[model samples]
Every structure is written in C-alpha cells, then in structure tokens.
Target: MPFKTYLINKTNNRKFRLDGVLRSRRLPAKHKLCQKFRQHMVLRTDQLPPKVDLRPDMTPIEDQSQIGSCTANCLAGAYEYLTKKSNGMNMDVSRLFIYYNARIKGNY
Candidate 1:
C-alpha cells in the first residue's frame, strides 16, 4: 500500500499526523463518475425514505486475506450484484481476473 503522510501546521508542541488517499493523484480526478448516471429529479428531504437497507441484495462476504486487491474485490462484489440483479443468479466472480487487468492498466 502506498500512503503519503503529512504533518499539520497548527501544532502546539504536539505532532499531528494525517494519512489518506492522495487527492492530487491522477486516478482520483481523471473521471467524473457522477456524470455517467442519468439525472434524476431531486427529492425533498421529507420525501426520502426513513430507512434504507441494501444488505439484503448483497451476497455472502468474501475474504481477501492480504493480497492488496481491495479495488478488485470491490469491483467483483459490484459485478456480482449486477449479475444477480440482471438475472437473479448468485455467482462467484474471479477477483484475480479483475485484479490482473486493473494492475496491468494501472501499472501498479
């Protein structure tokens, strides 16, 4: 895992550390994901459902041990969800396939 660490400027004789995704990185800004979705009418706060549960749609958990393939695993879960939603079939997807392809494209 690649992490960039930074020290805060407003420190009073104490060290403050911050570590997270690098915002300036290309991947984070390269795509505007929101634009891909169809625009829907904005719902008023009162019109929204009181409770929403998507857990029912989610399949069984997948253990990823420690191979640093979080992205691939996430994509696989999403793919499984789409598959089930499209054809109502619970399928096990190959995380390695997605991982290898992403790694090749990303050059990680």
Candidate 2:
C-alpha cells in the first residue's frame, strides 16, 4: 500500500494543517501494468499503407487562419464526412456558422 498526504492550508496564525490522505493498494505490480500497456499499443509499421487519405468528397482542407475556431472547423468537417457517407450528398457546411452557433450555445 502507498499513501499520500495533502496540506489543506497554512495560515499566518497557524503553522500547517493536513487536508486529506490518499491510500492506494496495488493489485498488480507497476512493471506488469507497463508490460500490458506496451503490448496493447504495439503496432506493425511495415503492414501499414504508405499513404492513407481518408478524407471524404467535398471535404475541403479549411484554412481557419485568422479565426481561433479549430473546434468548429473540426465539427463541420466531421459533419460533412458523415453526411456524405450516409446519404451520398456533397454538402458544404459553413464553419463560421457552426462556430457562431457553438459560441451562442456556450460550447466553446
């Protein structure tokens, strides 16, 4: 078992105060967990294709150069890809529109 102590406060009048203690009991060793994680993340680089372009049709590489609206751009791109794939329709969704709507909804 491992334990950690957290200090709540150190007031000018009082010296110090203990806030809480966190105790953790290990079911498996650290090395074992690391080995398992490494095994899960192992990839065969040679088997992968040299070039993979998964972008959908009408999915433009947007230049959100001036605006800080990367989240909106990504959302619109995903929407275009999904809609095109599902319905075979090539509709260009406006990133600015999505950005404004998200800002109104307080999502950003």
lDDT of all predictions: 0.80, 0.75
For candidate 2, lDDT tens digit of each residue in 1-108?
A: 234444545554443434445544555556656443443455599977799777645576889898999999899988999898879898888999988998989965
Which portions of model 1 show Cα errors greater than 4 Å?
Answer: 1-41
Location of the lowest summed lDDT over 10 successive residues in candidate 2: 14-23
RMSD of candidate 1 to the true fold? 16.0
By TM-score, the best candidate is 1
Where does candidate 2 stray beyond 4 Å? Answer: 1-53, 56-58
lDDT of 2 at 63: 91
